[model samples]
Target chain A: MTNYHGQWLKLSPVAIIYFAVQFVKDVGNNLIYLLPAILVGYNQFSENGLVIISGLSALLLFVAISALLKFYFYQYRLTDGRVQIHSGVFQKNHIDLPFERIQNVRFEQPIFYRPTNHICMLLDTAGSSKLEAKIIALPKGVAESLKQEILSHKTEQVSNAENEQPEAEHEQILNSRSVQDLIIHGLASNRIWIVLGALAPFFNSLSEKFIAGIENLGVDVDALMASSQYAFWQYVLFFLSIAFIVIAFMALISVLGSVITFYDFKLTRSNDRYIRRNGFFTRHEVVMKLSRLQMIVYQQNWLDRVLQRVNLKFEQLGASLDRQSAGTSGGKIMVPSVTQGEANDLAADAWPENKLSAINYHPVSKRLAVRNTLIAFWLLIPLSGVLAYFGNGELAVASITLFILSTAFIILSWKRWGYAIDDNFIYLRKGLIGVNYRCFPIHKVQQTKLSQSWFMRRFKLCSVKLVLACGGQTLPFIKRTTGEKYIDTCLYQVEALRKSWM
Target chain B: MLADKFSNQSIKPDSLAKVSAQQFTPLSRAYVKVNLMCRLVFWLIVVSVLLVLYWQPWFPLPKMVALYLPQLQLAAGLFGLLSSTYGVIADKNKGYAIRQHDFSYRSGVIFKSVVSQPILRIQHVELKHGPVDRHFGLANLEIYSAGGSMHTFAIPGLPEEKARELRSYVLTHSDIAEND
Candidate 1:
C-alpha cells in the first residue's frame, strides 16, 4: 500500500541536474574509499588482475544501484493539510509535515529553473538550522496550489476571535518593479563600489610603474632622466596615466558586477509577506512576513546620499540561513534597492500609520568637533616629528593634508548623527559614509538598556540601547539625564502598549 | 510578534509563596576562592601601575600618576560599588511568578528591566546547567520569546525540579499544544 495516493511522480527538469550532481558527488565521495582498495589490489596482483577487475565491478555496481534508487524511489504529494514524502527501497520511509508547524515557505526559480517551469520550495521551521523539508523541481502551478492550501490551513488554525474573519487567507500578490526603477537604482549604487574596485588596480599600476622606473635607472633611459630633471615629473605623469587606466578597468568591472547582481530586481507584496526576486543566473526568491519584521533600516552611502537614493533592509527573526558565502545575507533583508521616495513608500506600505518624514536632527556640539581635531592632532604630532627628523617637507605636507581631511570627515559625521521619535515608533540615524536610519515600533522592544561610562556619568551623558527580537537599536551618545528619562518613558509605554496592543 | 493576550487566575502571589526558599541552590564556597583571586590580581595591577607612576624616582613619575590617579581611583571605586549594587538588585529580583498566561523575571540595578513574556509567545525553552550551577543543584532557564528580537529571558539559580516544572508547563501550554 502507498502512503501518498498520487499518480506516477514526474521529475522536474531541475531534478535531472540535481540528480546528476548528486550522482557525481556520491561517486566522488565513494572513490576516496574505493580508490585505495583498487590501487592496492592492482599492485598486489598484477599477475592475477582478476582482483582489480572484480573490485572495480563491485564499486560500479554499488554506485549504479544507489543512484538509481535515489532517483527513482523518492515521491511527494500535496494533500489538504500536510505534505507527504516517501522514499527508500529495502525499508520504506515516510514523513508527513503539517502546515501549522511550518514557519515560512518560499520558492526560487533560477534562470535554469525558469526555462524548465520548475521551482524549489524551502520550508523554514523553529529550528537552529533551516531546511526542515525541501521539494526540488516541483511543478510551478502545483507548488502554488500547495502554497495556497497550506496558507488556507494556517488561516483555519488561527484561533484568535479578533482576526477570525478568514481574512489572513486573502493575501495580495504585489506588483513587480518596473525596469526603469531597477536601472535607476543600479546606477545610483554603481559609482562608489566602482571607485572601491578601481583602488586595487590604481595602486597596483602605481607600484609597477615605481618598480619600472627603478629598473630603468641603470639603463640608456637613465640619461634622459639624469640630464633633464624634468624627466622625474615625466615619470610621475606616466605613473598617473597608468593609475588612471587601472582605475577605469576596475570601475568597469564594478559596474558590470553591480548590474548583474541587481539586474531586473523586483519586489512584490503579498499581503502579510514581501516577495523579493532578483539575481541574473542563480535567481533568489525571499518571502518575509510583515509582522515578523523586527526593524526596517534605510541606508545611504556618500554617493547614495547625493543621489537621493536609499537602500532598505528589513531585519527579521532567524539566524543567517543562506548557505551562500555572501556577507550581507543575514541580519537584514534588502528590498532590491530603491530611491529615497520609493523607500518611504515601501515603509508606508509596511506601516501605513507611521509615515516617515524628511526631518533631520543634530547630534553633539563642538565637543565632537574638538574630539575629531584631537585625533588629527595626535596623528600629526607623531607624523610632524618623523617628517622634521627626516627633513622631508613634502611628507610633512602630505601628512597634514591627510590629517585635515580625516578630521573634517569625522566632525561632519558626528554633527550629522541624531534620532527622531514620534507616535509609537523611533527612528535612529547615524554614521558618516554609511548613514542608516533604523525604525521600529516602540512596543516591539523587549529590553531597554541605558549605560553610562565614568566620563559619560561625570558629564551627564549616557547611551540607550533598545533590544528587539531581530537585533538591538542603540542611541550611542546622548545626555545622561535625557537618556534615562527617554528610556523610562519608552519602557513605560512599551509595558502599557503590551497590555493594550493585542 | 504581538502575543495573544489572555487573562487567567493562574497568575497569583499564592503561586509564588507556595514555592519554598529552600528551592534555591545556595552559592557554593568555590565562588569565594574565584572572587578573591580575581580581586587580588586586580589590586596587584592597580598597585603596580600606581607604584610605577608615583614611586619611581628616576622619571617624571609624580606628574603622570597625578594625571591618571583620579581615573584609576574612580574606576576601582565604581567597580566595587556596581558589583555590590548588582548583588543587592539580584537578591531583590530573586523569585519567579507563573501567571495563568505568562511568566516574567525582573533584574538589573541601574537598568531595572523585566522580561514579561506570555507562554504562548515563547517559541522555545532551553534548560542549561553550568558545572558550578549543576554542582549547586541549580539550572538556568532560558525562554526564547518570538515576535520580538530574539531576547532570551533567563533566570539563573532556579532549583532543577522547579526549572523542569516551569519548562514542562511552558511547553505544555505553548503553540505546540495541538501537536500532541
Candidate 2:
C-alpha cells in the first residue's frame, strides 16, 4: 500500500529518467555545432584524451544537475475539480485545468520506465493550442487512479437532466491490425518519395562511388555514352534492373517504418468513446468520444483501390492543430489498411441512425470542367511557346504530355466533385488521385458560408463552405439555387437541433 | 450513377428567395466616418514615410528612378486616396441580422458573402477597442467558435456602450453546456 499524502505531491524520483531523456535531446541538438568544432580541433587534444574526457564529464554533470532541479521544482495536485500544476525554475508558471474542460487524458509508458512502473500523463483541452497539463513521470497506479477520478468528475458534470443517458456501458474490441495488414498499409501509403527526398544529399557521393566501382570492373562507361549506335534492348534491360533495385530498397524502408510504428495496433470501444492504441517505441493512445466527433472521412488512393483497402479517419473537435503538425494520419483516430466492409461497419456503428447507402450525391456544374480545362490550356500555351522558342523538341514533347495529363486530371476531378445531404447528415465527395468521402452530422456545423465570385456569378454558380468544430469543407461550383437551398437547410437544422455538438 | 437513392423533395429554390428577402439591420452610419478617418491616417503615415525617404540628401537617387519619382509618388497617393474613399462608401452596405437562434453578417463589395453562426455554437465573445477606435467612441465585437481560422463574426464600428451590452447579452444567453 502507498502512503496517502496531501493533495499536492511531488512526482516519483523515477521522473529523473524523463528529465534525463530531455537533457540528452537538448545536447544532441547542440552537438550539431559542437561536434564539428571538437573534431576540427582534435589535434589539440592530449594523447591520453584529457580534453575529450573532461568535456564529456562536464556535459554529464550539467545534465544531472538540471534533471535534478527540474524534478524538484515540478509539482501537481488535484483540487476543487481541477488539475493544478506548478513548475518552472525562475518564472514559476502555474496552470489550473478544470475537469470538465479536459478533452483527453493520455497515459504513455516509455520503454525505459517499464521496470520502474512509471508513466507519463498528458491532458488535452478543448480549444487550447497546447496541452493543458502534463505530468512527466508518475507511478502507473497513481496515473490510472487520477484518470478514473477525472473521468468520473467529467461525467458527473455532463450528466445533467438533458444528457442523462448512461455512457458507454458495454466495452467491445472493434478491430486490430495484423503484421500483414501493416505491410499492406505501408505499400498503399506513398512514403517512398519522402525517403527518396531525404537521401538527396548522399546521391552525389553514391553516384561517384558507383562510377568508381564500374571503372574498377573495367566497364567502358565513357565509350558507351559517346557511342551513337548503342543497343536499345540492352539499355532498357540495364535501366529496368537499376529501377528494380531502387524500388526494392524503398519498399524495405517503408515496410520497416510501418512495422516499427504500428507493431500492435488495437482499437476498442468503451461506453461513448473509441480508444486506439498503437506504436512500438513510443506508444500512442488516443481517446475520442462520439459526442466530440465532428466528421468522418473515408479515403482511398489508386494503390489502396487496387489492394481493396480503405483508410478511415475520425476527426474530433480541436484535433486540427495536431493534424497540422502530424499529417492527416496523426492525432485523429485513423483505421488504416482496412477492408471497405470493415470501414462501413465502423461508420455504421458510429452513426447508426444515418444510412450511408441512402446518400444521393449531386454532381457540381459541368462548367467547372470547361473552366479548368481552359485554364490548363492557357497555362500550356505559354510553357509550350517558351520550350519551342528555346528550340528544345524534347521539352516541347514533355509540355504536350503535361497538357494531356492536366486534361485527364480535370475530367477526373469534375467526375469526383459531388455533395449529398439527408435530414441529419451531409456527405461530400472530392479529389482526383485519391477520392475523399467526408460525412458530417448536420448539427455539428458551427458556421455556413455561401460565396460567389465574379466569374461564378456570371455563370449563375456559387460555392458552399461549412465550418465544423474540427475543420472546414467546401463544395465549389454548384448551381446558385442549389447552394442557397442547401445553406438554408443546413442553417435550419443547426438551429433546430438542441443536442450538444462537442 | 449511384446517387439516386435519396429524395430531394424537401429542398425548394423558393426557400432561398425567402431567406434573401429577410431584411438585415444596417450598421451605424457614423461607422463610415470612423473608417474614413482611420484609412486617412494610415495613408498619411505611408505617404509621409515615402516623402521623408526621398527628402534625405545622403540617399542616392538613381537617374532612371529620379525621372519618374514625382509621378510615381503622385500615382501612389491618388490610388490610396481613391481606394480609401471607395472603401468607406462600401462599408455603408455592410449589415448584420440577429435571429432567434442564429446571427448572420454580410460583407464585401465585389465578392459578397453572408455567413451565419448559430448562437449555441458560439464559444465566447469579446469586445476590442483600439486607440483610434476609442477616440471615435467605437468598438468591435468579436465572436469566436470552437475551431476556425477566422472569428465566427467580427462586427466593427459599434458604439462602445452598445458593444458592451451585446457582449453581456451573448454571454448570458449562450447556454453554457459542457463541451468536450
Candidate 3:
C-alpha cells in the first residue's frame, strides 16, 4: 500500500532541490525591491571580507536548511477519489482535494530533477484563482499513474454533453512550432519593447558606464562627438548604423528567449484534453481540458500580418477578469506564428462549427466615429490654440499633427470593429494596425453587462460586455437594439443549452 | 440523451425577452440613509487621520500641512460632501431582479449599467451587511460566477430577509441548473 493506493508517503529526497529552485526563483522575481536591501547589506558587510563571505554562506545555509525541512515535512496520501496533503514546517497546511474539484493538472520537470526523472505536478481548482497544489519530485511512473487516476475520476464526473466528443485515447499531434516559426514569432512580436521598458530605469547609469567603458578602451568618444567636421549625412549614417545594431541586438535577445521558452513545442490531443509540451531549460507539460476552455483569441501584429501568421491564445479561467490586464500570464496556452489555415484548423477543432474563414462580420454603428471626432476636435483644437497663445509654436504644431494622426488611427480601429453571432458561437474583431479576434460559445458566457454612458444614451447606442470565464470582452458604441438582440440570444442559449462551461 | 437535443436551430432574437424591457425592482428606500451614513463614517475617519498626521510630530506632513492647512481641509471636506451626496442619489437607481433563468442588477445614475448572469453560471452567492446596513435592516447580495475574482454584481440595499431569500433561491437554482 504505497502513496498511490492507501498508505501515507513522502516525496523523493530530490524535492529539496525543487524547493531550493523555488526559493531562488522567488528572490530573482523580486530583485527590484530587494536591490536596496542588498546594496545596504553589501555596504554594511564590506568593512571586512570575512564578514561578507560568512554572511553569504549563512544565507545559502539557511535556504538549504529550510528546503530540507520543507522536503522532510511534506507528506501526501492518495485515497479513493481524493488526495490528502499534509505539509509545512511552521504553519501547517492540510489540503483534501477531490478529483472532481480539480480543473487542471500540469507537470514540470526542472533541470535539477531531470537526471532523476522526477516530476513536479501542479493542480488547479476552479474555487482557487491560482494553482492550488504542487506535488514536487515524484517519480515519473507514479506521477503518470496519479494523473491517470485523476483523469479516470474526472471523466466519470464531468457530466458535459461534449464528453462524447472525440476523446482520443491515443495522443494525436495537433500543432508544433518549428525553429523557423519560433524565430519568426520572436521577430514579429514586440516583446523587445517590454524588455526595454523594464530596463528603462537603469538607462542613465547604463549609458554612463558604457561611455566610461568606451573611454577605458582608448577611444576619444567625447572628441569624436564634439567634432564639427562630420557632415550631416555622415552623422545620420552613424546614428542609423547604431540604431541598426541596437535593433539587431534586441531581435537576437527576443529570438533567444522565444527559442528557450518554446523549444520543442508540441501540442497534442489526448482524452479530451489539449496537452502542450515545451520549454528548453525546464520541460513543462500543460494539460487544458477541452470542456474547460472558455475562448480562443486570435491576434495578428504588423509583422504577423505581413507574414500571414496569427498567434492564438486559448484562454481559461483567470483572476484578473474585471480589469483589462493584457499580460497577466494566467491560465492560457499561446500558439505563436501559425498560418491562417493552421489557425482555422485549430479553431475548428476546438469548436467544430466555428466559421473562422467566412464569418459575416457586422460593423459597429457609425455614430462611434462621429462621437470621437466631435470630442477630439472640440477639445484638442482649443488646447492647441492655448499652447500656441502661450508662445509654444512647436508644441502646438505637434499637438495638431498628433490630433490628425490619432484621428486617422481611431477611424481605422472603428472601421475594423466587427461582431457576428451564430447559433453556437460569437466572434468579435477589432484592430488599428493589428487585428484581434475573440470567439467563444454563446453558452459559455458567464455574464452579460449593458452599459450606456450619457453620450452613448443620447446616440441610442450602448456598450455590451460579454463576461466569459476566461476574460471579458466589450463591444463599444453599438446600436442599443443590436446589443439587446445579442444579449437576448446569448441568454436564451445559456438557458436552453445548459452546457457545462467548466 | 443530451446529445440528441444539441442542434443548430435558428432563434428569433426579437422573440426573446429584450434586456431593456425587463422591469427592475428598486432597492429599499432606507438604503440611502445607510449609504450616506457609511460614507460619513469613512470621511470622518479620513479627516481624523489627516488631522493626526498634520498635528503629530511626523516631521514631513506637519510642515506641509501648516502651509496649506485651510486649503487641504476645504478640499477634503468638499470632496467628501460631494461624494457622499452623490452616493445617496446613485443608491436610488440601484435595483435587482431574478428572472426566468438568470438574475439582473441595474445600477448607476448618469452612467447606467445593467448586469445579468445565467442561473447555471452562478457558482455561489453571499448576503453581506455592515453596521449601518444592519441598523437599517438592509443587506447586500453578492452574486459570483465562475469567472474573475470579482463577483458578477453586488446588489446593495435589499431588505435583510429579501437578500437572504435571494441568496438561497439563487444557490438552489444554480445547483439544479448544473445537475439538469
| Per-model DockQ against the true two-chain complex | 0.10, 0.38, 0.63
Q: What is the per-residue lDDT of model 3 for residues A1-502, given as tens digits with 9 covering 90 to 100?
A: 2436877889999999889878877778788777646654775667788977897899899889999999989998888888888889998988889888887788888878889999998877766443277888789998898888788676655445446443547999999999999999999998999979877877886788789889999998978888898877898999999999999999999999989889999989986789989988899898898887888889999899999999998987773643224322435788988999999999889888988677988899888888787788877888899999999999899889888987898799999899998768899999899999989899888899999988889989999999987768888888989899888888888877777787
Docking class of 3: medium
What candidate 3 gets wrong by more than 4 Å, as runs, is A1-4, A35-51, A129-131, A157-168, A218-222, A319-330, A373-383, B1-10, B37-85, B174-180
Interface RMSD, candidates in the order listed:
9.3, 5.4, 1.8
Model 3 lDDT per residue over B1-180, tens place: 452473556656678877778888888888877678879898888877778767777476556658887677668888999999899888888887778788888988889999998887877778888887887898888878876655456888889998888877876674454564
Native-to-model Cα distance after best TM-score fit, residue A29 in candidate 1, in Å: 17
Clashes of 2: 1
Ranking of all predicted structures according to DockQ, beginning with the best and ending with the worst: 3, 2, 1
Quote the chain B TM-score of every prediction: 0.54, 0.80, 0.80
lDDT of 1 by residue, B72-132 (tens): 8667656755665456444554445555555555544454433455454456789998776
| Best first by lDDT, ranked | 3, 2, 1
Locate the minimum summed-lDDT window of 10 residues in model 3 chain A: A321-330
- The CAPRI classification for model 2 reads as acceptable
Over A1-502, each residue of candidate 2 has an lDDT whose tens digit, in order, gives: 1243337789888888789888898779777567646654666765658768998899899889988988899998777677788987777889888888888887667778778888888887765544457888878888878887778777876576457865655668898999999999888888888857766866786688789889899987898777778788888888999999989888888887887777798888998889888887767677777888889888898889899898888888755555465222344788878898888888988998665545778999998888898898888867888998999878887888898899999999999998998778999999898888899998888888878777788999988888888888898899888888877777766654456687
Better of 1 and 2 by TM-score: 2
